[model samples]
Target chain A: MIEFFNVLLVIFLILSALAVERTKDLLSAVIIFGAYSFMMAVVWLLLRSPDVALTEAAIGAGVTTLLFVGLVSRTRRWE
Target chain B: MNDIIVKTVTRIMVPFIQMYGIFVILNGHISPGGGFAGGALIGVSLILYTLVFGVGAAEKKFSHRLGDLSESGGILIYLVIGSVGIVSGGYFLTNLDAGFLKGEAGALLSGGMIPLLMVAIGIKVTSTIITLFHAMIEEDPS
Candidate 1:
């Protein structure tokens, strides 16, 4: 059961991550990236490394995304 | 449908989701989770709202600048606490000999500053991610 869940989680993580990087809409990409990072954090938790998960959540979903968004907000949209 | 119906309901849901995030962060140590999982989940929730609604709404409720500061603050808090252990004759993050509070393992007040630190991190992450999502949305929707 645990193994099954892990596999499913991994799939979700991969899908979300792809959506983040591949999507053209910046907003959608940011949202997807946040979701992707959240899934990664969960995987880290499942692997019994809460610390890694915590940092990822903070840095990935938290800070990096913020920087990206802030930058985008200021820049004029190309399209 | 940019109408009053959705806005009214979303206003209510926001607080609930935010609180739940705190719950997850606080309980991270005991359960199969920690600050990151809970924090990111909260961050994503906020992002969903921002994406569906707008950046102005999210900014009104949650400050972007504050979120940025909080992210750095969380890390500083964690490091400060860990450093205390070293200053008190213990290695970094050494709780045993560290001159700091240590309560029961399972209790809310337990785990010394670990739980507090986790909570701080959660707040930092959630706010940061939400701010990021808002920035993206606020970008020219071309």
Candidate 2:
């Protein structure tokens, strides 16, 4: 069951990564990237490493997303 | 946000979030979360406030000077705690045997300098994040 969940997480992660790369709008891409980071954090947590998961969730999903959104707000929207 | 519901909810939720962050930071010795996670939690809370209420209000609450002071002060506090060991004729950061309190294991007040170090680290990371966000969001003068 755990391995099944890991496989599912990996598939979803790949989809999100592709979505982030293929999205036209920078804002949407940033949002998808946040989701990707969050999914990665959850995967890390499931791997029994709370420390790495916490860091990924905080820095990757939280701070990096915020920074990207800020940049998007300041710049042009289209790719 | 201009939406009243979002604004109201944020006002009600920020305090609880900050409290929980402080809890995680203080109890790091006995819990899963340490300084980095707790500090990021608090930092993200402040960031949420900025996102919802605008940067002016957030900066008013946590001014640049205050953030800088806390960032440096955290390190200073850590250094001071470490130096106590040297003053007592031991190596730096020598906890539990450096004339500091050593309560029973698993106690909140136990771990002597460990909790103190965690607090210092928490302060440092929180301020660093807030400062970095502020810098990124601000309009460049160039």
Candidate 3:
């Protein structure tokens, strides 16, 4: 069951990564990238590195998304 | 941004998020989460406030001068603590050898200077994030 969950997370991670890159709307891309970061954090937890998972979730998923959104608002939204 | 629900939720949530961040920072030596993660959490709470409230209000709460002071003071505290090790005729940040109380293993007060260092890091990271966010959002001078 854990393996299945991990696999699902990985699949979602891949999809989010691709979606972030392909999305023309920069704000949407940033949101998708946040999801990618969140999935990656869970993957880190599954790999038994809770420390890395915490950092990834806080910095990658949270701060980076906010910073990107700020950038998007400051500049153009569409790529 | 003008939604009352969002404002109310953020107002209620920020304190708890900050408390959790402090918990993580204080327990960094014994726990999975440390300074950076905890600081980021605190920073996020502040950023959420800034997003919900106007920048003007957030700045009133956490002024730029305060952020600058904390950012520099955090590193200064770290440096002062590290210098204690050197002053005691040991390497920089020499922890146990620097005569800090080790306390009991798995205890909150254990690990000597490590907890202090984590606090310093937390302060630095939190202020840096806030400063960076404010800087990025500030109006263009040109």
Candidate 4:
């Protein structure tokens, strides 16, 4: 069960990473990046590093997304 | 941004998020989450509030002056605490050697100077994130 979940998370992480890069809209990219961070956090947790997972979830998904959204709002949304 | 549901949810959620952050910071030595993660959680709570209420109101709640003071004070506290170790004829940040009380293992107050250091780091990270967000958003893009 854990292995299946880990595999699913890794697949989602890769998909989100690609989606963030390929997305033209900056807002969508930021959101996708946040998802990627969240998946990465889960992966970290599954790998037995809860500390890294917490930092990744908070700083990566939370703060970085907010900063990117703020930047996107200030600048152009589309590439 | 002006949605009532969002604002209401933010109001309800911010306190819980901040409380969890404090919990993480206090239990850092015994737990997985530490100062950086906890502080980021707290910072993100404020950032969420700012997003819902707007920068003007957020600034009113957490003024730049207060942010600046805390930002400097956090590091100063860390430095002062570290200096305690040196002043006591030990290496910098020396916890047990510096004569800090160590309680039982797995307890909240067991880590001597570590918890204090975590608090300092938590304060510094929280203020830095808030300051950075405010600076980024408030900058006039001329």
On a 0 to 100 scale, what is the lDDT of residue B29 in model 3? 98
Which of candidates 2 and 3 reaches a greater TM-score?
Answer: 3
**By TM-score: ranked, best first:** 4, 3, 2, 1
* lDDT tens per residue, model 2, B1-142: 6889989999999999899889989999987888999999899889889888998999899999999899999999999999999999999998877898999899999988899999999999999999988888787744
lDDT of 1 by residue, B8-59 (tens): 7867786786676777788876764567767876786676566557777767
In terms of lDDT, the poorest run of 10 residues in model 3 chain A is A13-22
lDDT of 3 by residue, B85-107 (tens): 99999999999998999999999
| Reference-based lDDT, residue A72, model 2 | 84
What candidate 2 gets wrong by more than 4 Å, as runs, is: none
lDDT of 3 at B83: 98
Give the Cα error of residue B134 in candidate 4, in Å. Answer: 0.3
CAPRI category for model 4:
high
User: Which DockQ-derived CAPRI band holds candidate 1?
Assistant: incorrect
As for candidate 3, its clashing pairs are: none
Task: Enumerate clash totals for all models, in the order shown.
Answer: 1, 0, 0, 0
Which digits, one per residue and each the tens of the lDDT, describe model 1 over residues A1-79?
A: 9999999999998888777667878866877888888888889889998778876776677656756665656664332
Worst 10 residues of 2 chain B by lDDT: B133-142
Model 3: residues with Cα > 4 Å off, grouped in runs: none
How far out, in Å, is residue B13 in model 4?
0.5
Candidate 3 per-residue C-alpha lDDT over A1-79 given as tens digits, one digit per residue, 9 for 90 to 100: 9999988998898888889779999989999998899889989999999999999999999999999988888898888
| Cα-lDDT of candidate 2 | 0.91
Task: Please identify which of the two predictions, 1 or 2, would achieve the higher TM-score against the true structure.
Answer: 2
